[model samples]
Target: MGPPALYALLMLAVPLATIFAYTFWTQDGLTIDRTLTFSNYREAFNDPLYRQLMLRSVWIAGAVTLATVMTAFPIAYFVSFHVPQRRKALWIFLITIPFWTSYLIRVFLWKVILGYNGVLNTTLLGLGIIDEPLSFILYNANAVVITLAHAFAPFAILPIFVALEKIDRSLLEASRDLGETHLTTFLRVTLPLAMPGIVAAALIVFIPTIGDYVTPRLVGGPDGLMIANMIQTQYLRLNDAPMGATLAVLAMAIVAVISALVFLASRLTARIWA
Candidate 1:
């Protein structure tokens, strides 16, 4: 095979081999063995807590994806269609500038902003909006969704903007010339053309958000714990390497299946437009 193909296979092999090895391997308390067994996978699927955690992880990630896309579409449209070409690159850069900072720092910044003595609560209390600090603001599902949305917003914006920029101006002109209203033109012409970018942004945000441990751990309380949190518990807290590997593999499979479904849906939508 070619060099690229060989590199790809090697990369794929490392993770697949590791997971396969771990799934069949066994452990006695702290000691792990190479003996083959299905108990790890069985436990992961059969345990009620694991199942709930996985479902919640998927749901939170989906919410983040939807929120990012909804917020990004307008900013992307403004940059691609309304901004002067010379300034568009600068504007896009500004959108992504937050990433230069440590991601952990950013999440902690939100904690400072939302905590009891944080800016938000202080300002609200000063204004007499509420008598006390809201406990739910700092460590919950809402915090996870908000912080992830802020972190991943630029990822959603740039792709959709690039896709919108690539759309042929002549096609849009033709629609207008044929007496189509601006809204109609956008619905029929602009939106369909931008679907690819929307799909790309969703995959970019959704996949990573599902496995994100840091945001949930830092900001998410007990209720916001995800599959990644469990994997971390298995590996670090419990010292169960086999179970940790099993959870990692399960999370990977869930991400892959969701990505495949999004890609397939995008293809179907493209076909219908065609």
Candidate 2:
């Protein structure tokens, strides 16, 4: 590997090793007792609060992944099947325009739109649909899902679009020649062939959303707090690095299992396609 590669490995290795070591150690009054022990992991698994938050994070991440993939698939399908090839570039470009803005700005804008007396509430008020702002729309797990779905939309879209684009046009024609309807052809041919992309999209959205700190911090009040927020609290507010490291390791292990399942699903898709 080149110098940049070496540097990258160096940066990745050190912090990872440090965190792993911390998981084995215990925290004591603003100082870490560096002697190794399994107590952190023991406490993590035994604590109901830790278990609840971790599961909640994974569940919210799953919801975000599903929402983003469902929303993106239609747009990707439109671009791949309905739109003219010449206009496809413009459509993809438009999808990416949001990327030009900062993620923090996007989250803040969502807060504004979803907040009490924000656009959604004010519109509802002006239209006489409701006399008061809907308090349920923001500062909850629902808000986190909405924000993360919006944030990860493009990541889902691009992979799914690529998957749809690479599909052989002949397969659709072959199905049609056999007297298949458009819907049937899509269901039997296009959709199955596109499974790998959908899986990829799901993984992309699922992995990062679980680890996201900012969205949960902003939109997720007490109800919306995810595992990452808890880990952040442990490290920064609670001054418990060992516990934080333990949570981080546990998160990665869960995500690793998720990734393996997705990979197996993708391979199964490929075999079915073949």
Question: In order, how many clashes per candidate?
Answer: 0, 0
Give the clash total for candidate 1. 0
lDDT of 2 by residue, 147-166 (tens): 99999999999999999999
- RMSD in angstroms, candidate 1? 1.7
TM-score, prediction 2: 0.94
Clashing pairs in 2: none
Q: Specify the highest-lDDT model's number.
A: 2
Give model 2 RMSD, 1 decimal.
1.7
Tens digit of lDDT per residue, candidate 1, span 1-274?
Answer: 6998889878998778887688788778768788888999999999999999999999999999999999999999999999999999899889989989999999999999988789999999999999998888878898999999999999999999999999999999999999999999998999999999999999999999999999999999998889999989988888888988888898989999999999999999888987
- TM per candidate comes to 0.94, 0.94
Error of 2 at 81 (Å): 1.3
